[model samples]
Target: MKRIITVESVTEGHPDKLADLISDSVLDECLAQDKRSRVACEVMLTKGKVLIAGEITTTAKVNYIEVAKATIREVGYETEDIDFECRIHTQSPDIKHGVDNPLEIRNKENTIEKDIYDMLGAGDQGIVYGYAVNETQNLMPLCVNMANAITERLTFWRKNKTVKGLMPDGKSQVSLSYDGDQLSGIVSIIVSTQHIAETDLNELREQIKSRLINDVFPEYDLSRTEILINTAGSFICGGFDADTGLTGRKTQVDTYGGIARFGGGAFSGKDPSKVDRSGAYMARYIARQVVTKGFAAACEIAISYAIGKAQPTALDVVVFGECKLSVAQIKQYIIENFDLRPAAIIATLDLYNQKYKPTAAGGHFGRPGFFWET
Candidate 1:
């Protein structure tokens, strides 16, 4: 029984990705100045305008407009052609009270700060999903891995002048055929890239098919695969002007790309204190470990949290009938082996002292340099 699966990735200059870029740039700046910064930022972009609106609590003194402009410029957007509007608000003190100090009890038995675990709580009530598979070397679905690799290459080419006339905006999709548990072959590939008007697109297509696509998949024979590039001609108008964008709009692109269920939230622009980001990373970490330990060939795990709770409210682990251990046993192993608390997740992942800009553009999962991938 042969089945097909598809996954996709978009470049940094894609409209929504541009929004994510600006949001995470702010996140990175805040983390650089204060690791404890709590940010829940959302960005919107349209023709000639950038709107930044969100709650942020940080000691960092930042030039918000400059940060947005720098991020836009880095993504190949002509920053001088745009106007910026910012409506940032300080984080609500009520929420900060719980997130910063947590619930404390006095003198029950000399409640000391040394036992911080007792007071730590999740930043918000939400659910996060983590998934892993043995299909690829990186324990990622083959289609997603290939799709991201294709677009990452496009970015490299554009930035280094390897692909002349190639603009930063682009998207890639890879569809893989599967027979039972094994991947069969590539079914199709599609790449739509923005470009300057004068470039010969026909020459660009040949270059990509011969070099960009073929070079990325040395192990796979895709010479006869169905491929398409820029179905619409003259991609001169792209980025925010072509389409309006909002932060968190690319949730599926950020995660598994329709391969697995989402926890119904996005990751960028939020600090590690936001369980929407930290919990998802922790869940992925645990899921990957299950496969690495030889307990399963694939795993999908869910971690749920309730407001003002230090620990996970519930956990669901599915091994996809490929594991020797039962679900309960796997759950037990995770409980005994890992700390699912919000604070513990942050410390274990080192997310606070990290950069998020890279993650804002490319798909978050199935990528290197992220702790969740390891």
Candidate 2:
């Protein structure tokens, strides 16, 4: 079967990504001061203002307004007339009780012996999925990897002034042609970038082709790929000045880029205690290990948890095509070799100690330094 698969990515300066960055920044600050902080911060950004609102149980004493402004400045929006508003409160005691003592322990129904690792419970109940493919070196779908690379290049050029007149906000979309199940080649590439008023469209297009694309994808043969640069003609106005941004708006970009399913739980702004974040990372770790160990060419793992429960309610492993080991065997392997509990995942991945602001913009999966990627 011949088909086309497309994936898109946005630069860190994009409105939604900016909001995500701010939220993750707050999360990072909380974790830095107190390793046991519980943060679930959210942000909304629009013209001349940034609002921070969420439930947090941290003794970090962060100046929310100052942090938001500093993030805006670092993102190259110093000239904007942005003001900060904060409405933060501590986490509810109802949720805190569930998190502190799991349902099993509270009910006295725990079948197995309890330990310190089993004391902490899931912050909430939800399903999370993790996926990986062999098409790219990072075990990610090819189009998404390409799209992310293009947006990353745009950010690099804007910051380094490699391409004159480049601005922070930009987007990239890549389409790949597939013959049956195998990738044939790149079908097309689209780039929309913000620039200064003095920049010429013709020159910008030429520079994008000769410098940006060429530098980023030198190995790929793109002679026949339909390259579209700034299809809307101009993007002079961008960021909060032109549009509104809210946290968790770019969930697809944060994970598998539509190559697989997400459980509708956002990753940023939450601590590892939240099963939505920790379980997802653990799922990805399991899926990646399955593919890397040759059990499957592509893998997706789904783990579902119950609020106030320290154990997962369900576990499923889906693989594309044939597998060397039976699905039941693989499940058993995971049980014996890995621990899927929320607290154990946090320890295994070292989630509390990691800086999450970097994961806010770029696609979280397939990135090398993250422990889950290992």
Candidate 3:
């Protein structure tokens, strides 16, 4: 059977991505100052205003407004176009109590467990899924990888002035036809970009086709692929000026791009203590390892947790195409070899010390230099 899969990515100048970037920048600052900081930062953006609000427990002295403004400016937006508001507060004592004294210890069920990994409970209850495939060099789906590459190329062209009058906000989509597990051909490519008022739509399209698309997908045969650029005509107004952006809104773009199942939890602004963020990272790590070790051609794993509990409530895996080991056996191997507790995940990935700002805009899982990606 033939199937079509599509995935999309947005530039840092996109409104929702701007919010994600600002949120993660704050998280990065907090972690830089206090590695033990428990941060859950959120950001919202709209015309002429930016609102920063979240629960945080840290000694880091961050100028929230300045951080937001600087991030916006770095994304090629003018601070003069927006005002900033911050409503940050300390993490709830109730939640902190759970994190400090996990249910496993409080109930005396695991009081004899001497491992420090059992002490930190999951920050929240949620399911996280991780996926990997052999089709892409980075172990990501080809469509999403290509989509993100397109957006990255757009940013490159805009920043380097290779495309005249190109602005920051942009989006890219890739559609691919698959013959069962094997890819057949490219179906179509779509690009929407914001530019200055002086830019001609036809010229911009030619430049993108010649410079951006050709440069990004030189290996693919696009002679039969449909290329759509700025289908809605001019995009003179974009970013926060024309759209409202909220943190965690682009969960699909941040993960497997809908090719694999996701738990619907956003990864931006939240620290690793939040299982929604760390657990997902761990799941991805496991799936990538499974594929890397030749256990499966493709893998997707789910790990679910309960609030205030150190142990995962459930763990499951699904291997696609061919697998050397049964799913049940692989699941057992993971249980024996990996520690799914919140604290263990944190220590294993060294989540606190790493930078998160770079992850805010791009898809998170396949990026190089990230500990989880390794």
* TM-score per candidate, chains pooled: 0.95, 0.97, 0.98
Off by over 4 Å in 1: 101-114
Q: How much is 80 displaced in model 1, in angstroms?
A: 1.4
Expressed as tens digits, the lDDT of each residue in 1-374 for candidate 2 is 89999899999999999999999999999999999999999999998888999999988989877888888889888734667889999999999999998876777655666666778899999999999887778988888888999999999888998888988888999998999888788899999999999999999999998888887779889999999999999889999888899999998899888889887789889999998888998998999999899898888899999988888999998888668888888889888988888889999999988999999988889998999999
Global local distance difference test of model 3: 0.92
Off by over 4 Å in 3: 109-113
Q: How many angstroms is residue 129 displaced in model 1 relative to the true structure, after the best TM-score fit?
A: 0.7
**Candidate 2 TM-score, true structure as reference:** 0.97
The TM-score that candidate 1 achieves is 0.95
Scored against the true structure, residue 362 in model 2 reaches a CA lDDT of 85
Ranking by lDDT: 3, 2, 1
Error of 2 at 54 (Å): 0.4
Predicted candidate 1 versus true structure: per-residue lDDT over 1-374, tens digit per residue: 78999998998889899888889999999989988888888999999999998999889998888999998887888877788999999988878766655543222246444456546667888999998888778887778888889888999999999989988788999999889877788989999898898889899888988899888888888876899888786788888888999999988888888888778788889998888988998888998999888789899999998766677889998886478788888999999999888888887888777779888977777778887777
Q: Clashing residue pairs in candidate 1, if any?
A: none
Over 68-174, each residue of candidate 3 has an lDDT whose tens digit, in order, gives 99999999999885778999999999999998888888887644656688799999899999999998899999899899999999998899988789899999999
lDDT of 1 at 164: 90
Candidate 1 or 2, higher lDDT? Answer: 2
Evaluated with TM-score, which candidate comes out highest?
A: 3
